[model samples]
Target: MPPMLPPLARGDIEEAADACAAAPLLNCLLREVGEPTGDPGVHRLHAGGRLLRVRGERRPARPEVYADGGWHRLTHPELVKLAAEELRRHTGLSNSELPTEIIDSRDAVAALLAARARATPPAGPYLRSEQSLITGHPHHPAPKARGGGPVTGWLPYAPEAYARFPLELLGVREDTVVEEGDTTALDTFGEAPPGYRLLPAHPWQLDLVGARPEIRDAFADGRLIRLGRTAGPLWPTAAIRTLYAPEDDLFVKFSLDVRITNDIRRLWRHDLLKLRRTDAATASAFGAVPGSAAWLSDRGYRTADFAFEELAVLVRDGLREHVVPGATPLLAAALVEESFDGSPLNGLTDPSAWWTAYLRQVVPPVLDAFARHGVVIEAHLQNALVAIDADGMPVQALFRDAEGVKLLPQVTRAAGWERLVYCLIVNHLMELAALLAERHPGMDPWPAVRRELTRYDTDHGLPEIADLLTSPTVPGKTNLLLRWTGADGADARYVPLPNPLARH
Candidate 1:
């Protein structure tokens, strides 16, 4: 059995987990519909008329609400109940399921915290950074929800617990195999019998779909055969479905049945069919951009015809070839969350200089990609990778995940621009800026962001740059409202929030 976590009172563990869970939900509730009540820390829910407040800006904690003539502290379940009541009145729509997910998300965090107490983190800084997102997607209410599964079902594959395991190798009979683009890397994993092609599978995914008739039929008919597991373990990255094999310098993205954050983590067939086109466009766009910035291409994917979406494995370009020499690549989300071990942001003595270097490395590539190539890369925190040199300053920016990439005419320019602003500015820059301001109090990071945008305006001459600089409000994705309304995860809906970068 795995070593047990260090002894802690169960109440203490649950309290920490509740705090972890409440922050994001409160963030969402406050951002979407709650009205500020003069006091900077307090807000009134427009729908339910409940007064809510918390401490801290980046990661709000110690939640309380005005009730029964005094402020009452709320437990995780109580917070969920408040959220459900407010969202129902605000949206005028009832949702029973989202409330459960909010609770499940809190429970999942508790499990992760307990498990992490027992396990050792990976020695490699990169691995440590990838697995450090205990409180993920700061704006999403249920960022840690794991399909409400028991801890045993999902904990072994969780990145938060520093979990690492071998990829399950399989042989797909050539006659029944389906593939596109360059999947040559798959063959290097292991050998297959004659007339069979090598295919690598995430063991967790295989377990999820193993009982299906098609999978069982293939196994019995000799159309599919299990070879063995990989010799080396693959580390699960911040994006749970994607695994990195450090030895081979390779990334394999698999289909997961569990709902993580907003969506069921599956590589749907439609996205797979269009992967090559989207990836090619992004690659070409990056090639023309002038800098050390890189786009990790999703080269191709392979899966059995019978279980296309269920078993699909996408091969993405690894960091080895793209990263600057002697620089370590860390997940931007982890860095923003202050979860990355030995984070450069923590050691910054010169806030302005470090912030400038970050904006220079990250801003230009994203703007150039959109303006020049009509490719609106999903440059969100999770998809963006920042490599820092020995001196602990950002040296390069690398972006990944072709499925999230959107081409210009495919989505109207207006729609694409909204997404770019939301992903790049609101999601990526805002979080980093908040954390920076929190660490170095009274430092306004927005002026530096404004300067970066100003430079982009001078270089690119895009009208949206000017509009963004002066706009009072910028789009913020409504994750709580989206889930409560039962909207598709991919269907993003945004409402305006006060834009910090806007000129006062």
Candidate 2:
């Protein structure tokens, strides 16, 4: 018998696929894989999430959810389709090896066991106290263990880890906090100056930062670290932040330069917000939406009683039970780090590694949130956060960069021009897909993502995310990396966006 999965609902698999913009293959996994024994071996798959499992010596098989009060046998061909789709989605093989291609239930179960056998508890991402932010790998132990797992600290301020990093490695910090009229700058000391407060940093943030830090430090002491002076990208190039110490338990992202501050404001109020209006309208048609301010509140997952602008908190740590690693335990799932290897997938050829997490979980929620709330959110990768679980399954997604949030011009009071639309569709989605492909190695990934985007379009009325990726040449040069169009708007045929990083 094949071993079981984490007792996932057939529904969850389907739901994940639906959001992934990869439903056909996801649906196939559920149907073909059958019931998850938690044992990986054999099972039956059914649409609408019917699952069945194998029993003892011809033991009457069991049902995860018995529809007619009994287990039902599914055809073998059905299983083929399911597995084929997953294989296609993940590995994208042209033919099955029944020899090389056919993955027997026994082998599948063994693979799961192997993964679990190698399952080491994950460490806390950052150590924190009431005053600082610290960094550590989920697999790496904390500088000092609290108990079994590791103690998490919360700090009032994030120290300067970036300060220690080489100047070429500028730490880009993007976070969410309330904005009143329309402007918020990166924090300097730690807490939001007088007008703002720090917000919660979601795990999905794992993939956000582009310039990788040479070293990660979470100061237990109140000491602050800063990057030594060097040169690479210009300061005002984008929103760069300091550090959020996990040991100290607070994250700080500061921008000493004013240009970084102004750009953030312009991107949000003038660009992102304008896009949100249209998004909110289009998303509502499919039942996905969220309040504009409330959307930013997602990182902290709280509603601001006062205006969002009135509540700017730095990155703060939530209470976590420190499980000291003595025996085996489940660490949070999905801890893959998005780093660039100077590979084709990086911005030079495709997207950076960060977008992989976004494609798998984050973007979908933003779309659904905006649709359900009758409010628009700029879901482009810039405004999105994506995180995953131990097994690499995506779980949490948060949206920030409120200035980017927009109200559809035609549908609401909010109005903006092509830049908003271009950014949301072309700039964001294309970049994310490119990044995801970079991380997975051999996978074309872009096509699988497009497959998923197509699934999204089948349900929601928006253009498949792919439709927006466009090149800048035809429209004349612009600051955006690339440009694309939405399927809903112009009547012209689809055109590919020229990637700023991709050169002839």
Candidate 3:
């Protein structure tokens, strides 16, 4: 068992929850629909020209609107209303669901806070970093909304709540099992009876879809049977559906029926069919790179022929084999989203050297893969992990999630470059750079980033790099507008952000 956290009062939890929830909503409203005024921390709504004031830089808070001849503070609910109204007017689209999700996200944070106050964080640094995101996706409007379901239903499995539970196991008859490549690691979880294959399921997923007619009929006809659960518990990673089994050094990703940040967390068949090809290309790219950077491949998947989507489980390579010896792997998202007790960012003694090490480890591989292999990796914060040695300087960067990766001929080079900029630069590097500069006030993080990218461009001969450095703007994903307009999760829509590289 892990060590327990000290309890906090109800009032403190509510206040913390409000602050956590408001930051993302305000960020979205400001970036997507609100226009900045000359005054610091103040913006004018693009639709109505109403002036709004905020407090902080990274995580903006304490919102106030100038109305009725004075500034009136807005609560979390009021802020949500203001965002909805502004988006409705700005886009000329009315969305009743997004407003509810914003409220649901706030409520979910409150529940997570209360549970975390009484829960135990894992002892290992990797798992600790994986489960440390209390303020997830700093720019997303409803990053924590858990399908608007009851707290009791999701709190037990939430990564933010430090959840660890044994996977529910089942046996699929040989003829009914559908598998791809290298799924042998899953067999080690438990022994299957005579002619059945071992298939593990996320308990929450089964609870959501088990009663479907097809699944119920499979169990009734003896095509599937219960085989009990693993003897040990698996730690849920930042991506809540993916869990880590330390004993086996394996990651098991299940098909969850809930909607996380942008998409419903199901392993769709279209993506599953191309999984092997995608993983192979990514593996080849990383293999050719002459560095410690690695790719944690999604080796294979297993499912029942009858319940292909709902019962699917993917086997991913674990950290033990890829990470450098005597080093610890930490989630990139945790470094910027929230700092824990063992966080390397919190323990930084030489911020400039540490920032340079981080840039070297993280930047090259993504660019190399795009330029050399024609493979575009989704190297966003959650998909990347940075390993650090005893003194807390970065040593390696390992990236995962082949399902989100795009191949060259499948998408145009311009489109792939846009995505790379959004994921690698806007989402991953910008947040970390801002956090480092915020910590060390005198440090200018952009020059190091500019130098690193310039070296890569000089050797790789990618023309986009020159334009990127001099361009007035860089692409930023418009999550709030995407959800409001009900766009497909894969159909990325972007807005422009002032390019820090251009200024540096």
RMSD of each: 3.2, 20.5, 2.8
Kindly give the stretch of ten consecutive residues in candidate 2 with the minimal lDDT sum. Answer: 149-158
Q: On a 0 to 100 scale, what is the lDDT of residue 251 in model 3?
A: 97
User: What's the C-alpha lDDT at position 386 in model 3?
Assistant: 96
TM-score, cand. 1 vs. native:
0.97
Residue-level lDDT tens digits of model 2 in 1-504: 221122223424322211212211222243223345465444444333444443321112221333587745433334345444433443334434221112232222222223323332213332111101111111111111111111111111112111122122112222323333212222322343333333322111222221223213211221112232322211110123333333343323332211111122112223322433443343343233321211332122111222222112222221222122231111111121121111122233333233454354544555554444444555543344333344333345444443334454334522222333344445455444433444445645455445444566567755423333332421111111111111111121222334432221
User: Which 10 residues in a row give candidate 1 its minimum summed lDDT?
Assistant: 1-10
TM-score of 2: 0.34
lDDT of candidate 3 vs native? 0.91
> What is the number of backbone collisions in each predicted candidate, taken in the order shown?
0, 120, 0
Candidate 3 or 2, higher TM-score: 3
Cα deviation of 376 in candidate 3 (Å)? 0.6
Tell me the lDDT of candidate 1: 0.89
Q: Which candidate is the best by TM-score?
A: 3
Model 3 alpha-carbon drift over 4 Å, by segment: 1-11
Model 1 ranges off by over 4 Å: 1-11
lDDT of 1 by residue, 1-504 (tens): 111121345547787787778889989998898878999789999988889988776777778999889989887788888889898899899998899998898898889888988999999888898999988999999999988878888899999989999999999999989899999998888999999999899999898898899999999999999999988899999898899998889999999998888899999999999999999999999999999999999999999999999989999999999999999998898886544567887768998899999999999999999998899988999999999999888999999999999998999999999999999999999999888887788889999998888898897777889889889999999998999998999999998999998753
